[model samples]
Target: MTRAFLRPDDARDLVAEQFGADRRLTALDRLAGGSKKGVYRLRLDDETTAILYVWATGENYWPPSPTVPDDPFTDASGAELFATNHAALAAAGVRIPRLLMLDRDNRHLDADVALVEDVGAVTLERLMEHDPAAAATPLSMLGDALRRMHTTLSPKYGKLAAITRGEAPQTRRTEDVIVDRALGHLDAAATRDARLANAHDRIAGHVRLLRSTVTARETYGLVHGELGPDHILVTPAGEPVVIDFEGLAYFDVEWEHAWLRMRFGDAYPVLRPVDLDPHRLELYRYAQVLSLIEGPLRIADTDFPGRQWMLDLAEWNITKALAVV
Candidate 1:
């Protein structure tokens, strides 16, 4: 059975411990777009607010074990992922919401929780829709910040937590991992859609063919695996701060740009890296679409709050996937 979200009273002591006894939680509202973890906005009596992240089984919408346990892209959630990636991003000079408190011991909440500065409700996606001209500066800033992150190299390619703890799996070619994930997504997508099932062989062949064209590369850079405009928070001062860093890893910059291109659409040109391998971009783009198709369909199977939206996303991407092959 699904559990209920935390209530204001439930987190009052937690807020008091970190913030102060004088600051009381007046309201606790669960924000939208948090599928992996619970994101709540806590309003205090002092007219201030903070964001809370709860990493618990109840909060996650995706399957408990969606993919191979060791896969770098497998279920990038949890306090450790957030904390490790947060530290890595800060050290790399990337701007993220300031962390106020982290509860790994589950002292107050039954789950691992983190409290961070609330950067307001406006996301870069919403800002672009409402005021394109006003969004230009923050978008540019986001581009520059992303470029910096994409160029920050790591000795090995893996999740930041694993890399930092020196427990990263044996190094493999970036292309190999990409192809494997894409193929895996394709296999899963095939079972649900008749069109994908019919074209499964053709699509799989195309993916492998694309993989063969890529050359070997030694350098890998830090990348946010799930960077979308919705994940970027625009401050009142018009500065852009990126959120959702749990999927942080060292990977091919082309892979990152491919996702950027898909999510940003025409605006992607503003954030595009000048030196991306076209071959890698093509392969990754197709793979990313396949993932978009598979992941949403997987999530839609559950009683997620966004079930219809997830199904719609899968439907749209299935069309995109068919056009590719």
Candidate 2:
């Protein structure tokens, strides 16, 4: 279930200006899903639709309520990213809100908001939860979605080649940044960038392991960055829809497939007998887990612990890589 910050009435008031007095929000209910964007069931007349409220902030919610910025509450600023992504994905055969109205520039809003069609479908996660044996169905569907998205390149998406087959920006390691900031509190022996001093070397070795396994013939064009049960939604009829494009970047398109492989484990055959380099994939996912731990580390006001956790995951990825590579 997704946590919503806006009360139905408040959301209605904020959006009432868009739909017009005639199209009153006959009903508004919070739909369960999305940790990033605010989703709801909106009704007016005979139409039962979904509306996504985009907040400008990267917090992935429309600013329905106020929480401290550092506290991970709604940020009205990040809406631009969604607007860009939504439009891009929509052009690529993905279904998003109908976009009746949007603060596309959203430069002034505390949270960016957009009215879109709420596709009625159960998330892939729910389907798997209900019927674990059907996991492969969703993965293949996701692959199909990615195929549509990755088939062509667009500047609106920027260069994904930096990270993979396409041009995506290379982001700094969140853990590394955290470590540097928290070093003063850790051992006087530690410097800023509180990451283990040897981590870079280990990652380099792991990168080698990843590169070594690539069979030269394998080429990927883009990366979903984050793809899994939580981000994938399956409609009641077993339609898998990909959501959340904020994490998207150009990289090995196979990584999205890898993402499903990692999360679904043996239940999926998409990457069975996976051939990715063990060290590379391990390092990649280790870096990933570190990214996931950001919320916790920031909350706890700690860095070293999360870095160590990343290393543990890196180790596991190394082992998992051995099986696939």
Candidate 3:
């Protein structure tokens, strides 16, 4: 029989155990937007509220693919690592949720879960969508928050595990990790779509040019691997609080900025003083499209909502990237 992952009653029991025995879970409402985790808002009888996040494991979660190999992180230790990163980011003056408890052993749930403070914040994506013109303050705050995060330096480049283990992480070279992943994706795309063969050749040349012009920087820092507007939250007080540290890594700050630029237009100014090359930035932007394409490719057969839209967007972005290259 399939095991039930998480239900309201289970959440209530967990909350009761963490809070006093008399404390009761008055309400359990599932929040939306995470692809790999179940997020919920819990209200207690004492009128306090908290957010519960349950991570999916095994095949339920996306596995490493040729286009995006080297999965440096796992959900087994996600709660603990998230808490650690939260503390580090908070100390660096970046606003984030306070992790209350980590359920690693599945003592109260079927999978790994994290209980954190609910700050009553809205996602930056929603804010931007509501009023693009009024998003200036939050956008500026987001830039500042990213700058603060980058200040938390790492000794090496590539994955967070290597840095955390006190070992030198993977280094960047001309045929760096991103290039390899891009090539893999292009190969797959060409096999599925013959029309992409010419575009693949163009992208290959562009990758070579990108590597020739860009070199690894002396400084490496905490980079939010996925820094889309959706991951940022704007509190009721107009403060920007960054969330979702699972994809965090120790890599070039330029990659993070590149993601931000791809999500938000080029007009978004860089708040930090890191040297950025236009070509490198464009290459990273193209790489982001390649990474995005992996998702639709992985689930092409499934009945995923907006699958067509996702594929279309990937193709459109690929065309845009190729045009620039």
Which prediction has the highest TM-score against the true structure?
Answer: 1
The predictions' CA RMSDs to the true structure, in order, are 1.3, 8.7, 3.2
User: Please, what's the RMSD in Å of model 2?
Assistant: 8.7
Q: Report the C-alpha displacement of residue 67, candidate 3, in angstroms.
A: 5.9
Estimate, for each residue in 94-153, the C-alpha lDDT of model 2 and write its tens digit: 644456667655432456667666656566676667777675666676656666766645
lDDT of 1 by residue, 202-306 (tens): 899999999989998987888999798998999999989989989998888888888888888888888757588899989999889899999998888887889
Off by over 4 Å in 3: 1-5, 58-64, 67-77, 132-134, 171-175, 270-273, 303-306
Give the TM-score (vs. native) of candidate 2.
Answer: 0.60
Off by over 4 Å in 2: 1-4, 13-18, 26-37, 43-47, 56-77, 95-98, 105-110, 132-138, 153-220, 271-280, 299-325
Best by lDDT: 1
Mind sharing the TM-score for model 1? Answer: 0.97
Write the candidate numbers in order of decreasing lDDT.
Answer: 1, 3, 2
User: For candidate 3, which ten residues in a row score worst on lDDT?
Assistant: 68-77
Residue 179, candidate 2: how far off, in angstroms?
Answer: 15
